[model samples]
Target: MTAQTTDPAAAARPRLRWLPRYDAPRLLAAQMSLIDQSFGIAMVGCSLAAIILAAGLMLSGDRPGALPWACAMVVACAIAYFGRLRLPGRLTEAGAARYAHGMTATLALIGALWGLVAWLYLDVRMPAVVICILSLIAGMSAAALAVFSACLPVAIAFFLPAIVPVWVVFLATGDVEYLPMFLGTPLYLCVLLVFARNYARVARQSIALRFENVELISQLREQTARAEAAQHAAEDASRAKSVFLASASHDLRQPLHAMGLFLVSLGRTGLDERQRQLLAHIEASSGAAREMLNSLLDFSKLEAGVVTPRARPFRLQPLLRKLENEFAPQAEARGLVYRTRDTTVTLHGDPTLVELVLRNLIANAIRYTQRGGVLVACRQRGARAAIEVWDTGIGIPAAQHRDIFREFHQLGNPERDQRKGLGLGLAIVDGLAHTMQTRVTLVSRPGRGSVFRFHMPQAWDAPEDTPRPLAAHSLDGLRVLVIDDDEAIRGAMSELLSAWRCECRTAESEEEALAALAAFTPGLVLADYRLRGHRTGQQALDAIRQQLGRHVPAIIITGDTAADRLRTAHATGTALLHKPVVPQELQAAIDTLLREAATQGKGAPDRQAAVAK
Candidate 1:
């Protein structure tokens, strides 16, 4: 026998027709929420109305079943309402569909019970009492329509059962008097159904719009979070690049610094013209390399955000004179006349950073200008001084004015000329000026000249008690201790110090330093900031001081460009110098430290004598 085949598609189609279809999952969820929220209010309101209607029927001498049916309806509604409240907070789509179906069935059952009142009492009651009962049923149906309109099918399910039963009873009586009542009942239901359908459409549209808005806001927040993460990553990458540049600069400077010191010593030896000329070339090459490395170091430090300004009152005249003396020979060699107009104005700024700014500006002027002169001048403007560097160089074009201060941005040096510099001089000037809370302004025309100027706030003159310069101190018979991890650096320092008539004691570590100190007492300590065995120059200096029972005059020379190293060295309160140091600078620092020590020593003897007396 052939098996009776059931069409699965046909069966599924009938089930799908009964299931409510929504344009979006959120729309379905929203309708479900509305139903859940309004369920309790509708239940209580309809139940009370049914009780009141049942009481009125009894008072008018209606049937016994009215009171019992009304009570049973109220108890059923209470059970359904409270039971839903006990369910889970978040209802799944299938669960919500089941809820909607169950509520529709409950409402229909209540409507059918109300319809039973019309069947039993219409013939026996007075017309006034019957009309009042019908009115109450109509009112309750209206309320249900309004409450359940979020789902049209549910509204139709409750509405048809409530109104149709009354019409059916009127027709069954087969009397013309009940015809008008029967016709009006279906017509009134038709109007309510139309109203309920329109309301359901509007509600669904509003829910769809609300869901769209929520989705848009969620997308925006995700984009904003992504942007912030990208920004943080860029900042981290920039920091790493700066660190790499600093390390490379330090490594490059070490050998260059050693070469410069050896060259200075070699320059003093007697030599013929050709030898001297070749020596000059070597020195020039070394100097150029040093300048490039220094520029890179400055740019890296600025990028690392470690170049802090320490503003103090200081006379500019002495600083100007020093710059003039240092750069005069270079100007003469280039056959460019260099001039300076020094002012006795006391400016408030970090002296080292300000000096660096001025030096870079002046150097740029001399390097770029072939014929005309360069002038360094200070002009007074109210309570500020405008320190200006004027030069008849290859003036920058108006379009390229801002570009000149960018790293490796040069106007006419497309060949990457070493003599034209590494193109970081102006950049350094800009960075230092910014750190000093000032700005550098430039005025120029192509081929005419450029004037780079920045204002410095004038400070009150230093007190009269500021120490005056001591007489020139000699290095003869001075006791010096040199500590360095690099053997080349240690040997170079020993040779240079010995040449100056200093009794130099060299050591590679604290142990060796202490061993040397047993026989010789140092008048000055010069140490590299980083040493062997993870010890720093500061520690070496402290160790030496403890061994001697006195704070010895010390100088820290370093080739480290790390921000932490720079800060640590600065915090030591010692004269710190960067490597590839010029011979003149080294001698100047040494002489200054020794003179200050001598002055302090002179005061000590007087203090000791006073204490004794």
Candidate 2:
């Protein structure tokens, strides 16, 4: 023989040659592990077997051989049990085969001792002794098969020896009366071995499955940890993006806001044809910038969830008419027909919110449609009315129907043309629809046209009557107080206010503004939302009220679009305006706030609080 390998697995593997090698080393290691744990219980069983054998002999009056045999069996059990106790707790790859072989031999030796006693302790003439030895051997072998079945080779080694010697001793007697007992012993051995084979197969499969489950659980935990880490990183990135948008929006809007104020103010001055011509071009550019900024503001407001709808019963007919009037001229200029169907339907929702949603839809329809017309119509559907916007300019593809509603995702404008817009129109529409508890559904075809529709709950009951405002008063002698941290914005606002012939006072900080409240009582207050010294316009408004001892109509102009800031400004119940406010919008906000103030009697009513003396 050439040099043999020292690997114990190679040497011990042949013991399992009768069975297929299914991961032989690991399977052997698993068997050895089971044997190591359950060996003590198996030894306890051997001790009981020893007691029964000794007791059977004494009862048969054959005490001579009985004591000696019992002593030998007990000694065998002790050596097998004690030898395994000193081994390592877990089997090593190198030691698994070695330990498996050792356990097998030790168990086989105990079985051999039991078989030897059967031959020595048998007394054929004494039926009690003969019956006791055969019964004891059968029970011992069966017990061995149960405990060592995890290692099939060890179970077979222990089972065969513990049983076959009894049959051999009885057959040698050649007594025809015991013929059946000796002959049937071989058949019984065959049956028990079959059961041991089945148990070992089942146990092997169970052990393999248990290992697989442990491995799977480990992998699942690793994947879950990675997913959680990825989620946290995504959240951090989103927060960072929001912060960047907020600061960039504020920085860019400051100068743009001043430009609008100055442009409108300069337009009022008498200019030559050339000067006015240059101004108109500059004004056009400013208007486009204002549009984009407004889009951003609207998206931020909606994302912040601050645009709560003040729901009420409003006539849908008037809203439809207003949209038609506004978009008709724009669509006609584009050589597209803009039509609005007449309906006497009333809707139970905030009129402002409904108008906003319709306005964006109609604007998108008109903007996208170049040749064909745009149609705005309403259909009654049971308790709801479906308002539809149909356009025939450039139809959207079916694939893009969902994507078109995502913010900053535009179709047919890959170059991101500013005139085509910032791609926030549909997104804002979707958001507004969500607030109204409705979904906007789209049906479209490429190269054809698209129809966008959403249902509004129908107001079956007629709307309760509400007061309408009187014609807006002129800004002349309005006693306005303007507070802004930006110098250019404050100057531009004052010039614009002066042109409108209003008595306007400007303060750069909340402190300066609050001090100014001493000599003058302001009919209106205009403050910037973000200010120096960590103050806000709302704070200034509150201080102004505390100072004058009366409610004052205030407007908070802001360039910041942070969600928290937007919510805070909106919750103040003051008129909040975005920066880069042109003179037209600025005047409109002022007029609306002042008008509402007059209607509600909110202006500084009486500092005197006159007492009837």
Candidate 3:
């Protein structure tokens, strides 16, 4: 039978077999087990019944002493049950099986005694066939039950009582046919005993299989739990790394910014030609280090999913112009041509972020190309434009093309001149492109060149607006207020402004800034965010503004990467810049602030209403 399901009712159902309703091995084993438990309990009850029956038989003049033997057998069966329960399975199955092998002779002697008493004392006339059948049935039932109950001695004891009846009945009748058939009782009993053992084996195997399945399921659950825990730990470590990088980047940039600003100012003061050249080299090295750090920080932010793209409508041409100028010198120094193919078309959308992406791509193209030109081009594709950087450089291998976009993966080339970079350019480009909802692709051959392209959605229906020109400020005679905690940075910034022909008033603290304001009302105010002894540049600027009794133009330079810093700077209505500021960038910031102040002053008192008008 195919036992497919674990349902009890299904198990109990009948199956087809061209043999007995109960097969030899399985039927005998189950019967013996059932009988063993039932007979043990039944023996006591049967002893009482036998005593009563024998007593009643004696009162009716049938038998008198039969009750004693029946009662003794009952006592024996009870003892067997108790003993079997205590006996270990090792002895019953292994030792008992071996011990019972040659004990049939002793069983025959017991059977002879039982039969003699039944015949002589009871005087019960019994047919040879009935005697033979009864003896065999009783012998096999008792012996099988005893074996099932793990009582090998008791099982051997049953054989004697059962076979003796057949011998007695056969001798009494004096019939040859009856003698042969009656003597065959033990043989028939032994055959059934063998079948009973087979049933026990089948049941044991079924139970084992069930337990094995349960164990397998338990192991699988444990493995799955471990995998989940490992995954969570990996994620936690990644988050921690991002947090550490974010905090450390801000701290490192602060000192670098102070040093660069001081160096910029030092170059302006009475320096010999060689000293001036050395300072210029220092400034270039500083710029490169700052750029690499910024790239790493941006990549970390992108990986942490902290950067949010600020998409706004603006002209794209100015951004393109700025990138062209930025890479022109590098291209010239590398002896490679750099040109803008077509940037005449106007487009819109988060110009700052878009420019950052294009800058990295174009810079990488220029850096990698050995002898050929790098081109930045824009081509209209349907409603959007495809902006591409094409370089005839040592291209990426087919296997490594996609891998290069991952963080910190660099291509190897011994013969080519390679720029030392942080390997974050393409990673940042990929991240920013996704942020802008643009699709970027790379097409290249191993040794030829690479073309990196991305599509920018058109934000304007018409051509972009031309940039407004800024009027140059005459700083020659203007008084500038510089407030910073660092003495070197304050002095350097003062010198830099002085070179622009402005009279600079340097203050190292809020008290000094207030005192400076009392002496001279400055045209522009430049302050560092962090000041000495738990002070801030904002506090100093506020004091200076109050002393001047007017809205003095000011800008805040900071090395703080936290959003709170930017929020506080914006709330103070100050133009802000991150540190490691180049001289030209600082000047541009100052110029822009002054122009805004001029525009505001020439308009209505409500700045918003004036701009709207």
Candidate 4:
């Protein structure tokens, strides 16, 4: 009969819900698990209570079936406890509801059996017996509420059967003496029912909260994994890009080196005003390209550890004024103001490197800022001078504060516009800062602007070291040796050297240079680091020095930017110049090396002596 009534509805309709018939499988599973664990304890307790009640009845010698009733109830409870244990811990919604329904029916049967005491054994005329039976009925209802209240349907099911029979039996006695229990049974059931409904709602809510938290944590872990994967992939791609740039620059250096020399050579020849204007445009474009390559070379030099800072006391006013003059026109063209506050404060550092750092900072400030002005100022703090570059520009977030100093990192430049640069400005600035034993500090707020502060030690006792400006020193009748494997480069270099009125000879290999040495004892040797027959310029210089029995002044020019290559070339103890060298810089380097040779009493003693002075 129970199966016929409950099986169809169990499959078709949900018996448990926080709302109207909205079945929740997870919630049902939680409720069932709670009840399953405690059901056996509850049944054991019921069996014990039944035995106590039966013993009393037997001792009074009134109820003949008391011992048998206690035995029957205990047997039923043992069977139910074992059956409840067979139910699966994990359950489908329908299965959970059916479990609840089955438990409720089982509880009802036990409750009805207890109700039999009220029907057959109760006698209101016996006050002691009546009091004991009433107390047992109320206690059973209260226990059902406490143990099974997580599922409201089961609690109410056990409650109705146990209490209803007592009310019926007492009312039919036709005694006004039993009115209190008849009135009190419904009130007792009502209170327990309310408490059961409230406790079930709270338990369901708590379980749902736990499930939500677990789901959120799972999603957080998944997102974190994806973010880390993306970061690693981006880092790999950046490394690949750096290597490609280094290789491509190496290949283009030879041609660019030759081209720059030929352009200088061509400029010396006669040309009209219109032709001169066109030449200026070409030189301007070449200068821009060379600047980009030089940035990479500068980075390579730093990485190769070839650069050293010579700390000398120098005033900041001159450097700041020069930068102001150079960038003010640019700032004006951009419809923004540019200004500087001059300070006579002397700082002890390498002036050229300091200038380079300041120039990069100023350029970066001008590039990012669209609407507001940039200011360069200096302030004294204790024994240090703090030089600051302030810009009202698009600011960086606090999260990426340190990442901006990493190579090839840029924000808001996804298209990688060359005008915005190669993203190495701040990286170079940071590297130079570390080399100088200073930290470049930044203060920025998103959308407000930024300030970059650089500190230098102030010099008090040291004499001021002013910068020496480069002048056009004549290379007339200078003994110059130009050795290279490429014919075009050799020819172009010869023309450039001859136009400067220098006695220049060209060689293709070490053998050719050695053979030429018989007729021509050149003062200065210029060689390509990577020459024909796998011979490097360093090896050529070594061979030439071996033959001559003296240290002949030489310069090695090449485009390779590998740190290992730079370090290897630096090991030769010769002047090293990267390719695409402009005429002015090339002349300056040659003059500087020649002056050093004159001091050492080697290489064209008379002319080098004259150039040195």
Candidate 3 residue-wise lDDT at 610: 9
lDDT of 2 by residue, 1-613 (tens): 7986587888788886775332377777887787778788888788777877887777767477767677777777788788766666436656677777777788788888888877777778878777777777777777777788887778877877777888888789988988888889888888888888898899889989988998899999999899999999988887787778888888989999999899888888899999999999999998788788788888888878877787888888877887878889999898999888899998999898788888888888887877889999999999999999998868887778889999888888888888999899999999999999999999987767889999999987889776875676788888889999999999999998899898999999989998988887788888888888999888878888888887877777889888898777666666667887767667877777666556667562322111000
Q: What local lDDT score does residue 227 receive in model 3, on the 0 to 100 scale?
A: 86
RMSD of each: 6.6, 5.3, 12.5, 8.7
Candidates 1 and 2, the one with greater TM-score: 2
All models: lDDT?
Answer: 0.79, 0.81, 0.65, 0.81
What does the lDDT read for residue 49 in candidate 4? Answer: 88
Q: Give the TM-score of each candidate.
A: 0.77, 0.87, 0.59, 0.63
| Worst 10-residue lDDT window, candidate 3 | 604-613
Mind sharing the TM-score for model 4? 0.63
Which has the greatest TM-score?
2
Q: Write the per-residue lDDT of candidate 4 for residues 406-453, one digit (tens) a residue.
A: 877888999988878888889999999999999899999988889999
Q: Candidate 4 — which pairs collide?
A: none
lDDT of 2 at 373: 93
Candidates 1 and 4 compared: the better one by TM-score is 1
Write down the TM-score for model 2: 0.87
Clashing pairs in 3: 28-196, 29-196, 107-160, 110-160, 111-160, 111-161, 111-164, 476-501
